[model samples]
Target: GVTRSHSRPKVSNDNPYSEAHFKTTKYMSDYPERFDSLAHAREWFDAFISYYNHEHRHSGIGLHTPASV
Candidate 1:
């Protein structure tokens, strides 16, 4: 059960938000340069998601981590 929308009046048109967010994290700001290597990227990404779900403050959740929410 998922729904997404782009610029069309159709049945659940698709937008690329997930891909856009990954690009921002992996390439923008202070992301590591070594992510060009798949193994390194996987390791860092795992660390990031772990911290994200358990440690990071999610503003959209009223400054609570998702685990707390």
Candidate 2:
């Protein structure tokens, strides 16, 4: 197998930040179990985006919302 020097060490975790975000999104109380239609899915996503940007405080950016940042 070809190896790259830029690859992360095997001992280190891969993309922990993204993993955490996925977990948070999946675990939110408002996260729907399923969407009824395309429009409904869009509506749900819009609401989630609003909450994530305006309401959720991201610790990665000094505990500030993405909108504030």
Tell me the whole-model lDDT of each prediction, alpha carbons only: 0.69, 0.83
For model 2 the local lDDT of residue 50 reads: 91
Per-model TM-score, in order, reads 0.56, 0.68
lDDT of 1 at 68: 92
| Superposition error at 62 for model 1 (Å) | 0.8
lDDT of 1 at 50: 80
lDDT of 1 by residue, 1-69 (tens): 777854343336545656444654666455786667889888878877787778878566799988998
Residue pairs clashing, model 2: none
For model 2, how big is the CA root-mean-square deviation?
Answer: 7.8
Q: How close to the true structure is residue 40 of candidate 1, measured as C-alpha lDDT?
A: 84
Lowest-lDDT window of 10 residues in candidate 2?
4-13
**Roughly what TM-score does model 1 have, to 2 decimal places?**
0.56
* Model 1 weakest lDDT span, ten residues long: 5-14
Tell me the deviation in Å of residue 13 in model 1.
6.9
Identify the leading candidate in terms of TM-score. 2
After superposition, which runs of candidate 1 have C-alpha atoms over 4 Å from their true positions? 1-30
